[model samples]
Target: MDRSAPPSPVSSYSARRGLFPENEPFAHGWLSTEGPHEIYYEECGAPSGKPCVILHGGPGGAINPTMRRFFDPAKWRMALFDQRGCGRSRPNASLEDNTTWTLIEDIERLRVHLGVEKWTVFGGSWGSTLALAYAIKHPDRVEALVLRGVFLLTEPELKWFYQGGAAMLFPDAWERFCAPIPPEERGDMMGAYHRRLTGADRKVQAEAAAAWSQWEGDTISIRGPEARPAKFNEIDFAVAFARIECHFFMNGGFFPEENWILNNIEAIRRIPGWIVQGRFDVVTPLASAWALKSAWPEAQFDIVWDAGHASTEPGIVDALVRATDEALRL
Candidate 1:
């Protein structure tokens, strides 16, 4: 297989289900969420329409310009922001006071600042994790939820990807992912990598950061081989990404308890949730998604057989676009 080529999408989705035409944000600005860090936010589509906040995945990934196309510009208002140490947010990659709880509050502050009474929330992967946490804590403010690649961030799920479970399926990539650490350090991959990712050694940090980011790409690329994709554009971005991700994973996402979302399902039971997951996602597997759906039986679930962990997967894009359309009825 040509590892260099992009994966062929496996889907029966029609062109009609594709993302809406390219649309620029109507307004964009940075909101001061904490002492020195400002959450970078932008509003797209109709300013007065049903607002839906889109949380970009990664404790590090920023919202792409085209992401707003998932919603109908005429009927939906899209609000997107880069959490703590990511995107255009200042003090980039500094983990000062960054936590899952802080992100949840940032969402609320953004909503309050925008004066949106209640709005739909959409997220994928880590974004899904934050969305659920926010909704669970402030259910009254969430009109609905559209989640993709549900990630509960449980101990089991973390081990699956970091320790060995996901490694079994992608041994080649796993081999590379484990290559950076010493034999003794393999037992604690996150801690081992976190050490280098945050160390004072610039060379060590960049190496670990590149390896960490490539490992993620390999696991999510449904059609690619286990190989380092490419050098990250900047060492700063890579370090921040690897550092923040490892930070959250190391701290169990800063949750007060494990399975917090599942334990507090009652809060969002009537909040009208929609779950879209890829059958083959290695990062946040179907098991996590299924568990979430089981805990919140009222949320509609869609399993995209042809997709993988990436929210940009073709089948996933179709499902997400339609999911946004469904929100119009609410």
Candidate 2:
């Protein structure tokens, strides 16, 4: 299939500097978590340009240079980093220093490290969750938000993604993911999968990781195809996937019950924000996005018909670019 091409400037920059931009690459480095771990990140664009921080999904997924496309190199400086154990962050899959709260703190540390008073924020999927969490916690530090594939991290959202509605769409993948354990053990997915996927058996671990990732890929591109799907190999699959999933599950996605952000909307509403969601998004369903719009009708919410969880989705990407442009105006 011929995927829709991105904006000409986007494609041009991608070819020159990577998927992000060639204007100027941020010096490569790490920020002390001021704890056991250090967060790794890259910056680009002009130092004097308005700050627009980009957050990548996956507690374990690292930010890509491609993310730089959301902002104009001359107008906005971009900061991209790996959260805690994900991406360039030290000690991959180290449960000792990974969690939602730890990530929130890391963002704070990042802002301080960068010496930015406030900046527009951009994120998708899990990144969206982090953006919202950060915005609520420190609304003063957020200039605006460019959110795509909004993951609210509610129980319904979690259950659907894990073993409920979304699972029904991928029976084959679900069956494979669940096949390792017996019917009785099925109730304890975390325990059973953790034991087997992390066990010494290489075959057992690979199968589990593949099954887990297949479902995620399918959901990420609900309406169509994602240009870049995560590549999960046998060695990195089991431990990484298991760690992220089990962490979210055990901690209830690092947030409380449904409408966790509802009560706090009034606080962040004063800040300009955009909600870009796919109409058929199985990962972070459009329903939640709609609810968010209902709470803050003034918020810019675009329901892109031809997209899904992946930010690279044509419509989703365009919406983000537009959002960033609009935020700059405000």
Candidate 3:
């Protein structure tokens, strides 16, 4: 695949692409890992099609049925699994032994269990972070990568969204996000939220979880909070999503160093990859994607000018679907 020239912005053309029709998974089940966690996985698309693995965002974000629509059923065999504590995975919302490294191992376990030697990796947000870490660790197992809303889990990125940079743009939502924390604790927002998210009081944890998840739900898309799905506010989903996300963010993604992904870019330099980022994505933002493209020049980068962080946005859906279709050549 030639990636000498950067791809055009996904929103440039009048004709827009949409997700493939909804399809049922050909095979679905739970895999018990070495630890107490049991991962939920489902295979969609053709049984004999090109193998691909889809990684959902949030460190806590569970896989949804809509994610399976990104690939053509006739040409791609996509496998999607909920990370340790999210979705249908067992011991819901438990944080024990749920580091980035363990998740990487879970990917490998799933791969071997499925009898696939190599496959394409698709992820967005924190999913992109995990994909990069997994690819860096086992580049030989990755056939290609399709990433969106790139997040490298750096301190500046964390401070931007969690602290004040994003707040400058969404003061209304920011106020709501900060309402849960007192003025004294607001200075260290992540720390404050982490305390409450992981606190002994179930009420405190639930309150913190709702606030954390709601803030993200409120800001993730260009359409704003009202446009976000109602699932974002559900108590069960909010608890797992917020708790696990705060846990990962507080732990610095469990990377050995701050710029581990960029520092180790050489591991997958020759691999064919595409990065699709939203121009107005306050959640993950564009700087991280730019830095990633600069570091990995071989990968094609497509900026969606009118979109935000959510993968459900039309422009993002277009870019991702096109990227996956293009990956078929690989």
Top candidate when judged by TM-score against the true structure: 3
TM-score of each: 0.93, 0.86, 0.96
Per-residue lDDT over 1-330 for candidate 1, one digit per residue giving the tens place of the 0 to 100 score: 011223458523455377788888889898986577888899999988998899988777778866788899999988999889997887788888999988888998999999999999999889999999999899999999999999998999999989999888889988988888999989999889988987899898889988888778888858664322332446676777888999999999998899988999888999998899888888899899899888888888888776788766777887888888988998
Q: Give lDDT tens digits, candidate 2, residues 180-218.
A: 678898765656666665578877866766666665666
Error of 2 at 229 (Å): 1.6
> Per-prediction RMSD in angstroms?
4.5, 5.2, 2.8
User: Given candidate 2, what's the lDDT at residue 62?
Assistant: 69
Model 1 residue 207 CA deviation (Å) reads: 0.9
The candidate with the higher lDDT, 1 or 2, is 1
Q: Which stretches of candidate 3 lie over 4 Å from their true place?
A: 1-14
TM-score for candidate 3:
0.96
